[model samples]
Target: MKKYSPELINKLTDKARLLRCHVVEMIARAESGHPGGSLSAADMIAALFFHKLRHDPLKPDWADRDRMLFSKGHAAPLWYAALGECGYFPKSEFARLRECGSILQGHPDMLKTPGVNMSSGSLGQGLSIANGMALAGRIDGKDYRVYVLLGDGEIQEGQIWEAAMAAGHYSLDNLCAVLDFNGLQIDGRLQDVMNPEPIPEKWRAFGWNVIEIDGHDMSQILAAYDDAGEVKGMPTIVIGKTVKGKGVSFMEHAIGFHGVAPTEEECKQALEELGCG
Candidate 1:
């Protein structure tokens, strides 16, 4: 594994915190959005946008740029924040999230959004789309890689399994996936809703290179990305055990916050806790 310097790790860590702040503020402003999953995936997303993925914010449609597909698109707040922070669009656009006629929709729209590579809102289809992108890269002689983020709950969809099977069968080494395994979904705990346990083993059985890590740990997250890149024949999945509503004292592990946006007071508290207030 390639060792990352302390300076780099701290920069990524700060970036993740900033992303969380953006997520909370955007959801609170919209008065409707998913916070739990967005917070859960913030660290991983930050790592990708800041360090792992190869893309130019100045040229959002750069043909050879690496693609990022958010399979669990309810976390649009998180995705939008990353893009804005990366200069895909003005950060001021975050205020219009979910508003009628805004480019920053409730879910990703590739045509409208500058950095989003896929138009994804329906769960369980991201991996299939990613598979196509990866395969296209291979055929076009482009070395760009595809990265997709999956929700633990979203994987319950039958289509996710089908995509998994196809990715394994094709040995898509250029494709990497990260599972935001924060345990809880909108309804409740994943185990109670529909268990997708033994996640790592299941992916391995399907011919993926599985690397499990603490999703919040910058070191492990960075290392997992490095490890995934080295795998040659099969696709790799980094199963990150993350905390829902991470960085907020009250929201962490609170299932009620899943699909609900924070009220003004709650948003104040969350921003304060994130050191953004």
Candidate 2:
């Protein structure tokens, strides 16, 4: 594992802030989008695109490059920002979010969006897709890793468990499922909606190596990715305990922001709080 120096952590933190800003502003501009989940995933997304993922922004379809599937697809704004910031396309395209003819649609489309390996928004299905990709990679002897970011609530779908079981059965070590365990969903608290408690034990039971960490912590996030890479003979599932609508005073842990866009004033305040004022 590489050393996570204070400078590296600080850089990732700044990237997260920029990512958060993009998510917040884009959703605010759209006036009809999900802010909570996107904000919560900002740090992880930044770390993946800017550091962890072995992707080429210039060569979106380069063979042997790693793949990322947004299993929690409604959080498209976040991925759009990351892709843009990472140079898959210009970050300027973010202004066209949800536009009728914009490349940045409400949900990610691999055909429309460069660098998106799989078109996903349907919960529980992304992991299965990841498993398939991982299997294909194995068959081709490609060393590229497949990462699937799943929402905690999305795991409530039976397909997620089915995929999990398959990944474990095949010992798909190249497959890593990262859960955005923010503890809240569109309706309300995740526990109140449907508890996926004892999460670590459940994954271990299914033959996965679970690595729990503070999702917003840059150092921990990087360390977890390092650990995920070292895992062999079994898949890795990182349960990132995050806060829904993180970094925003009003939105943090607030279920209302789950699928609601922030107002212009709210966005201004949010950016100010994020130190981009």
Candidate 3:
């Protein structure tokens, strides 16, 4: 694995914290949004947008730019925060999240958003979309890679398995997916709701190169991305084990926060816990 310097790790760590703060504030402002999954996936998103993705914010539609898709699109707040922080759009747009005409919708909308590669909300479709993109890049002779973020809960959809089979069959080495494997979903814990355990083994059986890591660890997250790039014959899936609603004291692993936005008091407390109060 490629070693990352402490300075780079620290910078990405701080960026993840800031992104978490943004997720809380944006959801609170909207009065409704998914926070648990967003928080769970924040660190990975931070590593991708800041350290790994190769797209120009100024040229959101650059032909040869790398593509990042959010399969679990309810985590739009986290995606918006990353895009805004990376200069894809004005950070001021965060406050208007989920508003009637805001570009920052409850789920990603490629038509409205600048950096979004896919308009995704319904579960189990992102991998298929990513497959098409990866194949297109190959046909067009572009070197850009495609990355998709999948929720552990979302994988319960049978469509995900179909996409997995297809990706394995096609040998999509240019595609890499990160599973935000936080245990809790909106209904309850994944095991209680519908277990998708043995996740790594399942992906490996499907011909994917699996790399498991602590989702919140900056070093491991960066290292996983590096390792994915080295796999030549199949796609890679990093199953990042993470806690739902990370960073905030009250929200950590709290299923109640899955689809509910924090109130003023809760938001204040969450910001304080994140050191942004």
Q: lDDT tens string, model 3, 1-277?
A: 5789999999999999999999999999899999999999999999999999998999999999999999999998999999999999999999999999999988999999999999999999999999999999989999999999999999999999999988999999999999999999888989999999888989989999999999999999999999999999899999999999999988998999999999999999899889975
| TM of each candidate vs. truth | 0.99, 0.97, 0.99
Residues 138-200, candidate 1: write the lDDT tens digits.
Answer: 999999999999999999999999999999999999999999999998789999999998899
lDDT order, best first, reads 1, 3, 2
Clash totals, every prediction: 0, 0, 0
The lDDT values for all models are: 0.95, 0.90, 0.94
lDDT tens digits, residue span 35-141, model 2: 99998988888888888999889999998999898999998999988888888998888888999998888988898999888887766789999999999999999
**Which one wins by lDDT: 1 or 2?**
1
**RMSD from true fold, candidate 3:** 0.8
Error of 2 at 178 (Å): 0.8
